[model samples]
Target: MSDAPTTYTGAVKPGGPADVRELGGLTLTKVAVDAQMSNNCYLLRCRSTGEQLLVDAAAEPETLLPLVGENLATVVTTHQHWDHHRALADVVEATGAATLAGEADATAITEATGVPIARTLSHGDTVAVGDCTLEVIALRGHTPGSVALLYRDPEGTPHLWTGDSLFPGGPGRTTTPEDFDSIMSDLQEKVFDKLPDETWFYPGHGNDSTLGAERGSIPEWLARRW
Candidate 1:
């Protein structure tokens, strides 16, 4: 076995210590940058090619830029939310990295950040982080274009970036019953049904949780929709 850390605790705080986890051929770093909202930004690096990808520029460009160094390949916005891309313009300008988001929310994200998305992603799209690829899962409800990224580690468990869609307790906060139902349905069909219980997921805010841990709560989440 390698000397790298085998266990990952996905906890982070504002101006964070930045929890990091090592997987086969990949390293995952989670940072909490937006102090007010406590938004989480993830930095994924490919050990073989040294290419990096940032998920959600969120806020605090100064805090994010140094971690980026000189080799950022792409920045993917999970949704068109303002808090999620607050530092998009700054980060992209500093790194000249390509920008990506779900197709439906591309225009809104550009409007919010003044940084046009280089490519609009879809439910089945694949994003490359050097040699490794992340499969995109479009989950509406939190936002019309909210999306999630799934990474299947060859030597470990499947990892997911859930954005603001699914959290530890239940699905994210939705405005109306319609929106709540929409997210719940997508989470059921696309995420819970398709993925294994062992899959570990990182959320957009707060701590992380696994599918196995949250599986039993689905019924409760449905009964008491928020």
Candidate 2:
């Protein structure tokens, strides 16, 4: 606790120089990758035993694999987007890690990545990384099976990994008004309402933002319908 990082900036780029944050029992590393997508990837390692789990093996495996050292226990694809899973097959092959994803998107992810999901997560389900636990939340838009992972530390503020579902300024892009409404409703209820304002969220494509920072803009987000 004394040596833990107080906050995570979540700014990163492809290749070297990942942003690392040491929470109470979990160590989080964020890397922004390219294929020109500016996609984000997260590595969550357990402090006690070094059991590692990765979220979105987006791209640039050479840069990401070393960050995990060896023995990555699991990889979770937040959704079935091609950009978000560009390196999924390579990562799973390299580490022999079991994969997880939202139930609705599991088949699509397997279709895209050629790697099967060992487990399909649903809303309220939990993912364990060593001693820490991440709660799965179904966001239901931007992609049919989009999911966000929420982790609450016993001694710190909660953190969320929102893969293309919600971002700093607004909800993730949707193709239609109906899709926009679906994502927005989930954000308002499953995310903004259930979680506290102090919760820090990591988006799939950009810098980190807190629920408190974006809460006031919900009305504007609704008006714009993006």
Candidate 3:
């Protein structure tokens, strides 16, 4: 896999393929697989312990397995979305890594893939990833149990893994008015209103973006109501 020039602490150039970048003490390896949709799979590793976390088993397990290394500690599903878990079973089978998902969608994700969820996470819960920690943030509306993970470096800079909840230009696809409103509320309170401008966000699909670059478009996204 080629290394993308971008990193959580640096600017991202959209359309980059498989790449590995550093985030202080952690290493984030990204790969965009062509599946039902353009799904981005991330492998995060703690430099100190080599314990790794694989975020969103999107697709192409054969390709992802190598990047994930042998120290995988957990395989976390962002939501119960089929596209995001197409390769979940494969990766888990290969790595024997514990599976995790939001409590609400835990059963569905397990039933659909036959890869039992080892643990169900709730909002504000911290997932121990080797020497590092990632906080869970529930993001509903995309899927009833959608979630995003926030990893704060030693310097306090935040790096979020937004699984189809908040994207570059707007929130994820929500059909009904109620669903749209729910997602919008989650994005506002848990995201925009809280995180710092320089926080780098890695979405489930496509390129990554910083909070500062996306904050200005909230009003426009609201006006569009998508």
Candidate 4:
């Protein structure tokens, strides 16, 4: 509904889709797209199987296509926000990969992007990304159905892809007090309390942060009440 653009100058280096970074055993590639809003799209590949999972097709299908490669197994839309799905239609059309999203937002995502979501995900659901599985952690509030994807490596340290729910210093923006309360409660119980301090969260936009780094700011985030 809002077309306000956002940017993260230092959080991530905006690069072409071909750039790939190592994340423990997996390969993580990120590209920052500047459109109505600046959104960070990520592609995660299983090093062993070489299968891929595309996260948030924010914009520019041409750029995303190369990063996605030929073994894309699933395309995940973090939420139903327009900004996040801008490139979804084209990317899905090209890849023919299965699309997955939270059940509550599936209809809206389909209506907005004109791309059918192949599977509906809920809290505790696991999606296979090659040899690794991404566990869905539903975080309600930003939308009635926003969720975070978690992939735990062999060492137990988790990598989280959070879309507009939990951020670096605080929770995502909410329009009303009830929505704020809902997000705050879920984040406290489902995320901050449940996930380990070593868990690194990659947000939809901007920089990534760890639970350990943000643990001390919970009280401040709560006190601000925004």
TM-score of model 4 (CA atoms): 0.90
Model 3, residue 152: C-alpha shift (Å): 1.0
Clashing residue pairs found in predicted model 1 = none
Residue lDDT tens for model 1, 90-147: 9999999999999999999999889989999999999999989899999999999999
RMSD of every candidate to native, in Å, equals 1.5, 1.5, 3.6, 6.2
- Candidate 2 lDDT: 0.88
State the lDDT of candidate 2 residue by residue for 8-98, as single tens digits: 5677766547888987778888888884788889999888988999999988888778877677999999998899888888888889999
Distance from true location, Cα of 13 in model 1, Å: 0.5
**Higher-lDDT candidate of 3 and 4:** 3
Local distance difference test values of all predictions, in order: 0.92, 0.88, 0.85, 0.82
The C-alpha stretches of model 3 lying farther than 4 A from their native spots are: 1-17
Predicted structure 4: clash tally: 0
lDDT of 3 by residue, 1-226 (tens): 2233344332223244467777766888878776447788888988888999999997778777887867788999999988889889989888899999999989999888999999998989988789889999998888889989998777546889999998888899998888888999998999889999988889988778889999999889889998
What RMSD does model 4 have?
6.2
In candidate 1 the C-alpha lDDT for residue 56 amounts to 97
On lDDT, the leading prediction is 1
Report lDDT (Cα) of residue 80, candidate 4: 89
Ranking by lDDT: 1, 2, 3, 4
TM-score of each: 0.97, 0.96, 0.91, 0.90
| Candidate 4: 10-residue stretch with minimal lDDT | 1-10
Query: Once model 2 is optimally superposed onto the true structure by TM-score, how far is the C-alpha of residue 195 displaced, in angstroms?
Result: 1.2
